[model samples]
Target chain A: MTDSLQRKRVVITGLSVVSPLGNNIADLIQQVFGGVSGIKLLDAPFVDQLDCKIAAQAQFNPADHFSKHTYSMLDRASQMALYTSIEAIKNAGLILDDAVKPRMGIYLGTGMGGANSLEEGYVRLYRDGASRLKPFTVLMSMNNAAASAIALEHQITGPNQTFSTACSSSAVAIGEAARLIRHGYADVMLAGGTEALLTYGSIKAWEALRTLAEEDVDDLGASCKPFSANRTGLVLGEGAAMLLLESFEHAEARGATIYAEIVGYGTANDSNHITQPSVNGQASTMQAALADAGLSPNDIQYINAHGTGTQLNDITETNAVKKVFNGHAYKLSMSSTKSMHGHLMGAAGALETIITTLAVNTNMLPPTINLIRPDTECDLDYVPNVSKTLPNLEYAMSNSFAFGGTGATLILKKVK
Target chain B: MTDHSVSSDKVLDIDEISKVLAQMIASKMELDIDTIKADSNLKELGLDSLDTFDLIFNAEDYFKIKVPNDQININTLQDVTALVHRLIVAQKQ
Candidate 1:
């Protein structure tokens, strides 16, 4: 906190997504806005063993984008992360020469890094009784594999770190990356999260926790219905999202197109329960973010809630919103894009933050689809079932409450 | 490790090992088999340390011989082939 370390404004210049709904930003916008649910019955060999057979799977093939020699050392999660980062850099029109590369860094998050690779290795060792495994297994299965791959590819020498706080992993990553820019630690950072834990092992573990949504009897796609009276639980998903964050001054100097300004970020631990959401923690986190932004609750127009379609989470989050926003919660529009994209675990916050930024930038709020029954306890204008245009939409928020009792809130302001 | 030895009569010579090594390198580097000379430097042929390790691992599986860690200083396909030939010959004894 010296003169050179004075607070600076950080703005998102580029965004890319490898989501269940779509791969590119254009397709993502179309699918999310059109209320398309990406959840479907899984196509894996072990799907028959699990009670919940559906998930929101990204339509991606690593072989299509990488060479055998290159992708052979990457996990499914790293593949999505590297691919998304490339698209984000291209979208930002960033020229990462040697000088800029040193100042650039990456901060990524993942809940289950390299799950597919690890599970495959386990099968080889245990099930197949294989005495030896490939050398690439360890490299591919590490938690920081995605971030390391991006840095090695781009020759970024700055602080490359990875966060793994379960569902709030990417939220913490994005917020911390913004903090670094605000405090002059780095000029630019590629911040985001990726998760590809829809493997057979991962699904079985989630099923053991009894948190996965049952497949809808009539339509598998509607398995996840956040804030609805008939909501079951969160549908597992696999995806990646990356945002290029830089100082506002730097963006202005380069004439970059700004998506939205990251005005505030707040994170808090519940210290109450390991897997249950806390109302006080969620409320205080939102209030802390509002205070950090130097704005009251009434100034925010939209919120992309961490609505995971679970009964407890929905009611707890609704009560948290009411506690923090007070009467303003009724006036502002809120929705859970997870109803369409399913719960992406570690990648959820970054994806929802992008959705929130888009809502603020385009003046169009995406809806929480499949919310047909309307749970009375969760009383709020959820922008249910369809997208809407909100004139003069200025600021929006995205909240991520993780299973480990961590709550993270990020506020985005429309770039004027 | 389990005995991965091939039949005693099928012991490969240096030339045969060189041919198989060339094919592995060619397939891995996506180059024509004719383009990968036995004497060409592996680095010059666009094979880094990781690529070299991968090629060696595949060669070990194919020839059923363990290329010792000390033999990892191979500079060319000929060198790799010679090392594999030695390992296979040792395995026969």
Candidate 2:
């Protein structure tokens, strides 16, 4: 497709996050750039005997933040998403009229849906009986609950979907939402992911992988180190982000503040491992996104690396970036926002995109905190523990490659 | 994955089990540390029976040891902890 004809001009009009770092996107950016680490020692209940006992808890409870009745109806993951979606839609100054409300879509991504509910139902059967099941069990447990909750809360009448692809879930949702808007499938799309898997099952699953950082061995803030020599593993975090994506024309028609232009998005399967990453497939996805944006590696300045900090992930990611940029890897200022918020898993893509969007808008890159010792194979300008302002850069890219070999990248450009 | 692959792994450790159990219980009750006592009757806590199911599910995951249906009768917090301890120890064998 020709660059001109292929261009659908998707732009971020508003962004909001209910994240471990903070409750809103602007606050989250500040929290990250200010070097305020969200990782903390997991309290006793959450710290039973795991090797790693640190987490970036969202610090916001739906029951306290929203109506109790409303909270009861939605799963924790969906509740986290709804908080951000409401804020984002409002931040866009979108008091949607009937004309526009019907055209707004919601695409949400999640790692686990209503896990709490599923567990609760099982408990009921174990403790009580078959009759103890909640009437809304299936509705709450369905993966699309996040999207459905957003649509219902905001009265959005357009396409509603939930994408589930593990960690890449949200990134895929964001890209798909952009496609939907650009293709006139929807005018405004609330896109992102929400996750709160700090529960026993979720943490245990991660524990099985032996990936959770065990610095509760002590209060080590740098346990989330993404590409460093001492990098152990990711510190699990919880939360959600919602980005208001609309057609450039449509956004301008509504006089929305354009945060950043979604220039390109590319996704590819490694056809490799479910957990481990492949350098070739990762590089291919990055290359494809740059190509999709009609941008050469030279045109991009900052990258929000999908640096999970796990040994294999960081090494392979570092290799992918080097291969994709070749010699220009040194010129790029890459960072993992996960350093501040911990790994949000399904929500990581949406949260990282917000950081990348802000970078293009402010010309300042958020730093990768706790990156002290650089590993030999993983070498790059991972902006360490501080934000760097680069005035000349016009484009930023964010990458998210998840388990099951799903990898995705999105390129954003500064708006004139 | 029928979970046979789970127990066969050595990543399972003593310290890991406690951390997993703590996180599971807290997530179920949707409460902070103060409310989720190790010995507190899970029923007496603010979390109802629905919350207990989540606790059990998460416990199974954290330990990577299947909590059989017969063992799901966790009336007290001690029961939860003791059962988990037994299952986790058994996984080592």
Candidate 3:
């Protein structure tokens, strides 16, 4: 309605990720291009306690990155977030001087915050009969811990917030951050998600939900097969991904290397079931994002799908895509990076968005690895098993649908 | 509140209370028990406000006596030990 609102543009300037594939963004993109699978059979003592023993665990050691005192205060999720934030900020080359520090903020998302710490604390208290739990247990387990920690670490005094929207958490976070910039609330934001819920408690809970993929074969890497006929369900994963978003003018003025412009963000709730996703909800969200971007469905070239490898999710998402894009759905390329990275839970959308941005920036579409035996009902070109290169890509969309029937979509465009 | 009364014969002495308090603070701070002095200020021992609150909680659980808000202004290990001894003595009576 206002002139200021109409003129402001949000763009992603820097991206970093701490994933199962790798820590740095370049290595992660490289691994994805190589059609690598990060999922592995977890060989921990706790694996024996769960129905599903495979997860895309990050190959990172927090001790190597943090001091004993600092590490002791952080949860695994917070550590991953902080690590990625540092990398993202450095990559953006934006020095948070006193003038900029107050305006810059953080928006992080996590489904289960500090689950490992909570599990460890409960085990110590109930099983070990310890009289006193750790002092920082509450701080470490809070859902906003990562956001608070990042804000404190960077001294970001503006709009520090966290979203806990299950699988759609990070997508909502990135969407909200973009809105903030578009509304002229802030100039820069560290937006993304982190998750480290690989503990016994978390795994057992997911097992109870019956959503974990059954690992029948020895090679657990093939466990997650999104949009495939043989796909069982999603394998759990732990990681973090962060994007440094700034106003387009701010980035251009600072001579920042723009990755891609985040043009549209849309979010909607199904209001139907707690776990089951609604096709209408998914379609409407995608439609809303396209409408927000002021672009027709035909203009989009690629889509990073939220294919969770679940029987219900893949089919529902495929139908939703068909509904939203209509004829163009068959033409444009779409794939689920979750096949390679597994489900990062709240961090899934952030990583997928990063991958989608890379696809738009480099014109190289990452494949949905292990998509053998495509589902009959789910008929879409999934860029199956191998990466593709298409130069001068125009528009790409990243979709994230969550457990509480929340759906979010982000439309990104190549900054040519 | 649940009954936290200790028998007069089972009441803990100041020395025992001091030792437990020191161990609790040391554990919370991740410091060696031998390094924490009874007269040294908790702030000097790297116990921030949150650490002090947790130490008070652990002290209450260990002694099975409720620590009043007034006693939370403890600056040294002696202060905590003295407060715990007073609370225990009062509970016994």
Candidate 4:
């Protein structure tokens, strides 16, 4: 490629997450290392009415973190996004002034934007027989509410966008944010995904889908066992994770702590089935990401699998990995942090990408916590049950496969 | 049409209503209750459009009265107190 056509190097300058594991990156990383599963029996009134009684709920109180006016204006998802964004920006040490405000962008993802607000509105309108709804209901319940709120809070005037592609939403957000930076559209981007669909309506909707894990498990932590032979289904989760991505030159000029370099992003659609995952699509996307980074499959030492704990998804993802990595599949370490944190849906990829980046930076692989019995088909080394340390890890990939057959992969290399 | 019930003839207490309204506004604005004054302009309270909306909704819930959408233009705390008294009287009638 010509010098002018060369893509700019994008590096992760900061990371933050409001996960069930914890509210900040340090606590979340500690939980991941300790194999602490955040899944628990939900305490909502609708829990008795649903098939699944468990979820990985974020430990956040909007009243504690935001002003009443701010919390009223924000849905749960937006609140989490704003909290994570503030932490990430502060951690990145990027002061937003008049000069940089216009160039800073926000790319966020949410599977069900403001579902809590929508549910509350509906309850008030129907159940309570209230003729008038809250005036901010429409604003809070909109899919772009989180993104817009983040932009308004941070004064980011650049391309502000939100992606709602089911579980792959945040991964796509990160990928698109990197593209914006690589193409010289922006220097700093706040990118990630957040979801707060723990409301009655949200849980009931998932119950109707019948993909939630059965509620009879003795241990709630082991309910979501991705790639396990006895795995039942996915446990719903909610949280927000944000990453501050900046051009290499921008980060270095500011002397920011660079976590890892995001070298490649690849996304593809199965186009075959909406709910069913396709190995072909997954494999192709990983291959495409490897190609984008100009690295072979053997160069990657670890993969943060989408691993939704559903039988079909786990098996299909394993087959895809084997096809793409060939002989290197056995040597590579792969884990699904979702097994510990449940599945954050839209925010899954962002949180997992943070874990993947940390793995590359620290050379310590997070374990797939609940994998007591592995599926015969999924024979790859999953770094099961306990965290592992690798020496001189070079590159890692984070994968996100969604319900609509959308697949996204990002490649991050250890900073030299 | 009017009913000559004792409750209908009773005038709603303005001071109590003002206190309730100020508390709601203070809570919404995330300010101390003592800092909010009844004479302060609702706009000067640093409440944006959304915050104003929430304030009205909360007021309706507190008084068990329906606040009209057009009444959102209430400027001062006195104006809001008057509106609430009017709404409560109208609701009772």
TM-scores, one per candidate: 0.96, 0.80, 0.89, 0.94
Worst 10 residues of 3 chain A by lDDT: A1-10
Clashes (candidate 1): 0
Rank by TM-score, highest first: 1, 4, 3, 2
Model 1 interface Cα RMSD in Å: 1.5
Off by over 4 Å in 1: A1-5, B1-9
Off by over 4 Å in 2: A1-6, A44-46, A126-131, A216-218, B1-93
Which model scores highest in lDDT? 1
What TM-score quantifies how close candidate 3 is to the native fold? 0.89
lDDT for position B11 in model 1:
87
Query: What lDDT tens digits, residue by residue, belong to model 3 across residues A270-333?
Result: 8879999989999999999998899999999999999999999999999999998899889999
Q: Ten-residue segment with the worst summed lDDT in candidate 4 chain A? A: A1-10
lDDT of 2 by residue, A1-416 (tens): 22435456899998998887889776777888777788887653747666667888888778767855468768888888889998898888888789888888899888887777776777778766644455568878888888888888889999898888888889999998988877777878999999988876677788898877657344466678888888888888888988999989888987889999998889999988878899998998898898878888988899999988889988888889889998999888899888888988889899999988988988888888888788888778999888888987689999999888888899998988
Residues A46-78, model 1: lDDT tens digits:
888888899999999988998866777899999
Residue A208: error of model 1 in Å?
0.8
**Scoring only chain A, what TM-score does candidate 3 earn?**
0.98
DockQ, each predicted model = 0.46, 0.04, 0.19, 0.67
* Residue A218 displacement (Å), model 3: 4.0
lDDT of predicted model 3:
0.89
Candidate 4 regions off by >4 Å?
A1-4, B1-9, B67-71, B90-93
Q: Residue A128 in model 2: shift from native, Å? A: 7.1
Every model's Cα RMSD, please? 2.3, 12.4, 4.2, 3.3
